[model samples]
Target: MVQKRKYAALFIGSALIVQGLTACSASNPNPNSTGTPVATGTAGDKAQTSTSGEKVTLRVMDWADSEKPFREKFIKDFEAKYPNIKIEYTLMSVDQFQNTITTAIKSGDAPDLYPIPGNMSLSMAVKGEWYQPLDPYIDDAFKNQFAEGAFVEGSTMLNGKIYSIPAMASVPSTLVFYNKQLFRDAGLDPENPPKTYTEFRQAAKKITEAGKGKAYGIIEGGKQIGRWKLAAMDWSALGGSGLNQQSPISLVTHDANYDGKEVLDVMNVFKGLKDDGSFHPKTMSISAPEARALFGEGQAGFILQGEWSIGVWKRDNPNLDFGVMAPPVPDAGQKGFLPRSSYSPWIGMSKTTKHPKEAALYLKEYFNKDYQSVLVKAGDRFSILKEVNESSSEIPQFKQYYDIAQKYSRLVPNPQIRNPELASVYGNYKDVQPGVGDILQGVVAGAIKEPNTALKQFSDIVDKSLDTAIAKAKSEGAKVDKNDFIFSNWSSDKNYSQQDYKSIQ
Candidate 1:
């Protein structure tokens, strides 16, 4: 079974407390714009105190579970070097991790550092007003070493301040992990994976017929609510760039923008799969691990997963014979809509930190070559540094995915969570639906009809959600600079396909 990581927060706590002025600056009229505090005091700050001392303890939490042998060893190695830093490790489910940290912050016991998503990073940076600014430490040498998107320098920058740094950077594109044995049984060439949507569907059909009673051609996830594999992966494969990446400010929250005839066609293909009964009924609720296990045991032909799957599979079954391929495109020569999956839980030090210099030193070490290489080797994670990719020992199967990412990958910009106030304008009708995945599952199962309408409704809500979020941010002192947020290079012209459900029916 696959092991999942949860929320990881970094906290350095000391018994000593230093009080100071807590007031919004005159330069900004917004009630929330408090100049990031410059912390004073060296004795209790995490940066100043060595963890080797019996009295000093440095609290570090990571979402990476025990299954990640590499991270475990890395932590042990770091602790061995910094004997004074008595690091405490805590494991929490992904669902509970964020809430746990938020509650700790409320109780004044938050960790000194923690991992945060892109949306969370922006939100906390603007709302918390606690992380220390590392500008003083970001010298020319440091700046020159990092890549263009390493810090997400453009997206996470707020009011001329940067709050977090990504340990690795890459846009995540979906990957197809198939059992070589199963492919051969189905009369397909395991070495030559499908290149287009038509070929993919044809392969799935043959695999299903070959599996007989014991296996399936494909098993899509159907649990949760409206957002399922059919919508996320299948639609993306059919060339649906629902959300434009050209603009840093415009996030895909609404269906009207990207949910025309093309999306419906994507849904139709998925519906056809359900009609053929090639998927498992429990696909929605059984979890990703279950799906992986099924494929590993030769009960399923193909599974769609992120980059980590390769590392995970190697850990579980060292001898499993499988091949990794890019998800199929709609055409033979054209590129598919590959969603950027390069994600790293980011680290940000609260501006309220007393030992800013010390924290920067740690950050520099964190992003150093030696440490990153170890993580990549053990964690099966891709690094942000271009040099790392050029020199990585990743297997050829995984390397192929990396090579493809250079040209076809796209990031989801201005995610909905980053700016909640603009929810309505951006088409966000409700808080992110935990059960959304299940809704998509229902469509795949024939339990729900009009899949396009359902998807559109969800999309519409997200679109308005962003519109409202941006307006509120502007009203609340956020600078509305169009050039910075807009993606002027993106084109939605002839290459895109349009669908009409009524005409098809």
Candidate 2:
């Protein structure tokens, strides 16, 4: 996935010698009456000291929007503060960021900071000693700025140290966004949206019947490799916790009903939607961008999107009338659980970095409230601070999403990195596909044998995969227990009487 750099430049370094004076051939003799030249320090010393009159350049990399004007504005203000430091930003695509960052790390030329996705690979990040720990730099003052559970204990936390800081945290699971116009055209009430799964299905069905070839009730992304997205979404929306205290461990090697019922129940809903022809046929191959585009163009009615899609949708279709709401739960009595979705994008220092203090100063100052507010306005990312999120005035489009995120977000502890051997036991998107495809194809094809068997096989594969990964991690000296993967505890404003805040694991 490495894109070739079209332009390249090379520089050769060597010791510098003062040339003889030309023109007037004038030379100043030492005041001590000894003809001697000044001493020159080592190359390392030269690098350590910034030129007195020149600026020190700090390089930054990100996969998010590079052209967003807010970033440029932030840099201008940052430069004004540190007149001697120049910030250079490089942007890359998320798909290619890993390879790109790896290359930079190898050359010891990566930017001062960049975001890393929150999947299984992050586990390796800590294990491989690629990141610099922030414990020394982080005091109550620094930690207080971020919200609680913004950093998962064992997952993002490694070896009793916090190595990364999630840039813009979001509710990763439990919310679904729908189109207003489509709902209206289908004779469904736009203002009071669905609050239960039954209502959701009914609303989707109405849209399909009214739309004909124009629209679909819902779009299923799980049919393709995007099933992970579906799993995450359902895990939260359905209020299914991951491995945790109250929930305890569900041994994949021995238990039959550990993780199956919840996963299957979520899958069956989509299978029903697919069978009903409520989903677009093109969903299997559609990427996230494609889904966004389809929603923007008003081709779909209800979409399972989050705050991340808000900014893009507004930009793409400013005229479109849209509304945001929590993904409907099973009943009004049961408040919906919004799964914390994406891995909190982290800003980690290089373990091999020689300028730890300087880097900390940059992060502490640069990512402080002022600039972070700029990021919140420009991007759809939620702030990591409670004060900032609660007091937000700008970005009206994202207000609802931010509010729900602050209140109902939860997470699962299952790691999501890629490992070769475990891929067979757990299966990848390819394994998830046939089962989901069978459900979809069966719904459209009027066959149950394939979808049911495929789903059971798929679940077995996932269970086995988890078992393999756990064993592998143990062999590698990881201090992992079954409880580590469970999410028995949960916190919410409605669940508890305390007015401060609550967390659901």
Candidate 3:
């Protein structure tokens, strides 16, 4: 549900526009119930309560279509509590969000708060002065309500100052969502899903064969650049590939070996599916949402998506019986692990906003535990808070994915946590052309004949890109090195915690 966004910055040949703020503050603070969010303090750390009876409209923008239902009602309630403040919320499309936000900032028309675009890095956003530091509006008691490690330096907090708050759990990745009826029609046990690569391939083949042009083995949005790898990464990550779900660069090696055993093995499975005609006819042309719709319509036997489908399908097709499970491994045994990095920042306050207090208040109310519960029920994703997840048992399907993400999730080494200065080092690397996603898409689409050569070339490009990024960072006086990116002592089998970074040395 928390879609992976690439860091892409748009340049309009102008500096970040700035607007002068007329200093205003409110006195006193109080802790309130779930309906009424925590009150702010006069101290800069606490958000100043907006007491001016003047009417104000605060602008907000985000791509979380999954959270729209709760967010809309939350906004309406918030307006009821603060009659003078009206929220103009914009739910932007995931694909166009980055470009639109960047253009808005360039034009000095940015929303009150917006998530850092996929193509833009937090450091770059901060360095560009696109967001104002949030420490002045939020206090410790407010932050303490979040789960452990929610406010991470170099992520939510940079240089001891907070910039953004994580809105969703970071653990959920792609999973197998299969139609029970389709599995039964294929002569497969709808209760027992495939666990091994062979079994998965055979099941898909059987499903396709049984459909007789009525359906396919599995459906995917192949037209999108990242769709293929989004599902395939689960196979690679769970099959001892050390695949960093967020990026191609492995946390263990801090480099990529796309042509290595982990990736190649998974590629073979997808290739086999393609050769066997187990993919939907429109798989290569449809978008991910379209593929999900078709899957919901029983046009395919299975789909690889996030747990958000639990809530989505429940609302759209309450009678639809879909079983959820992890993706198949190379064999029955597991080889690799999934990285559960600390909470990643979700949205930040715009520097040019006129109503910082109102915007900060909205963010607080929107990301609280109350909203987190809504998140779980919506099946859009899990909450960042541990208590919210622990309290959720009624939603069994969503709970299943939560359990899966927790079982395999490990605390991987973070180069930025080890060296906060790596913020610049991180934002320096450029996206390699024909990336892992594109390469896999091309292979499955039958456009590429030599995956070996392409994978190796990609690995080489990653190495060069890492080297160039380090060199560029050094030139920029970041005080970073390639070794900072490497954690030779860290194992893929176990977690590398914050304390481990110190202990390893």
Candidate 4:
């Protein structure tokens, strides 16, 4: 799930206090600003303290309040290990963090370390030099410690330089969680879940029929547009086609045919369920969290969600019996594809940090196996280190999901679409008319009669957006070619490869 920004103020603990002047000034150096005193820690070496025996305090910021316990533990351990250094951890709401951090950075008062917000594209951040490249501090031995695909291009790397490390393993948002007891009560085999879309729809009908208004076959929150888009992308990929599954902007490659067939099929599935009275009555009215709550309360038989939901369900409904399943495919024997990026919630150093050496030390320790274990065991997030995950004591369900992510997931399309300049142009075309999310919501709510027409309109808007972005990029002296958008030999059956991109070029 993308980390959204929060707008409300949160009461942080006294231990994590905000130091220095609350107000900004031209001459009064904010300790959090990039202009603070620089530490002289050598690249790939341990941090050294000042000759005067002064303590070095580094300010770190993140928005995950749920992970506060783990963060506190890490801080305690880190300070114990390095007696000369101290860490002041600050937890903020997502919205406030992004807003305040951006403002602080502009005023030269950015935190020493913070997470790269999900809404902020990595390419844009790299281009703006907001993050300090970690290549200098990360030696070959350090780089080799992570799994082969842990550090991915367009996520952790830009122009062959590393700027950040992934805070957790990539978890695809396509997995489905279903109530096994609900299936059994509906006279369906709990052991044999639906594999094809036809079977899935039939199962939903049976469950709903059995409930007679007390339960729904499936549940989804239509109020959140992003949830709809995610569901559409997941189902389209299962149907062997996807419009924007690979990237924010759909690239019309030569072999990648997005004629709206796959999307239409997906939309029709929801439409069929809606018409059959299989979906929750409030599906279109609630938010994603509310939908999850309904599902946990045994109001729905199945829910399409990510691995993270496992922990949520366990915490909220301890007695609920649930099982994870791969998304339904178009055909019985066909395999479902999972679209995933390389890294998420990337942690990095601020370019203007006063203590680069101490920050590097903190980062190195952050990825340490011992520290990663705390994140895995306490936070329930998958570890980026291969060894930690392989030997994890996490629940068997999460381990199973991790295995699927490792074997079945494929990286999204080329890094070109991440270009900040191109993204700006493409974003303008997204809402030229009702977006895909709006169209899908309308279809499920019985507001849209023709899914094909709506999909075709969305496709045209995307094509025009791509064209506009290409033209603007060229005018700005960016060496972008229109042909880069075309992947001649690409196929949904297999993952996209450099060879496919090379074939078109």
**Which candidate achieves the best lDDT against the true structure?**
3
Q: Candidate 3: where is the Cα deviation over 4 Å?
A: 1-51, 245-248, 251-254
Cα RMSD for candidates in order: 12.2, 15.8, 7.3, 10.0
TM-scores of the candidates in the order shown: 0.72, 0.66, 0.87, 0.74
Residues 181-234, model 2: lDDT tens digits: 999999988888887666877888888999988888876443322223333323
Expressed as tens digits, the lDDT of each residue in 1-505 for candidate 1 is 0111111111100100000000000010111211111222222233434423443344544343323454444446555554455445564432345567667666777666654421243444445554555566666566555655444322334445566555445434245778788789999999998887678778877888898868777764343121243244324433654433222122222333434554455556566666776675557565454566566677777776544455555556556788877666665344345433222225566544444544554555555555455434432455555575456435555566566554464443333223323222222122333222334566676787876666656556544544555576676665542232333333322221112111221
How do the residues 1-505 of candidate 3 rate in per-residue lDDT, one tens digit apiece? 2421111111111100000000000001111111322222222234233445678898888766544555666677677666678889987545567579888888999999887754445677888899999989887767777777778776677899988776555653556889889899989999899988889889999999999999899998676554464544546777776655333366544677677787788888888888899999999887666677788888898887666556666666666788887778887577877555555666789999998888877766765666566556556566666677666434567778778767776656666677888777666766676666677788789988668888888788877876787799899898998777667777877877777878765
Model 1 accuracy (lDDT, Cα): 0.46
Against the correct fold, how does model 2 do in TM-score?
0.66
User: Between prediction 1 and prediction 4, which has the larger TM-score?
Assistant: 4
| TM-score (C-alpha, index-matched) for candidate 3 | 0.87
List the candidate 4 regions with Cα displacement exceeding 4 Å: 1-69, 75-112, 117-120, 209-215, 221-223, 242-245, 248-259, 281-294, 331-336, 342-345, 351-358, 375-379, 403-434, 442-451, 496-505
Instruction: Tell me which residue pairs clash in candidate 3.
Output: 6-118, 6-119, 7-118, 7-119, 7-120, 8-119, 8-120, 45-138, 47-137, 240-336
Query: Residue 480 in model 1: shift from native, Å?
Result: 2.2
Ranking the candidates on lDDT from highest down gives 3, 4, 2, 1
lDDT of 4 by residue, 1-505 (tens): 1111011000011000010000000011111211212221222234344222568889898655434444566677667666777898877644456578888888998888886653454555655668888887667767777876555554456666777676555555556778888899999998788988889999999999888898989998667554566567656765656433334333333322333577677788888898989989999997655677799899999886555455455555768888777777775445346555434426778998878777877877776666555445431466667777666435556666667555655554444433323333322222334656677889888999777877776666556655665677677676665555445554554666545544554
Off by over 4 Å in 1: 1-55, 65-67, 96-99, 107-109, 117-121, 129-144, 152-154, 220-258, 331-336, 339-345, 350-365, 410-438, 445-447, 481-488, 492-505
How does residue 393 of candidate 1 score in lDDT?
37
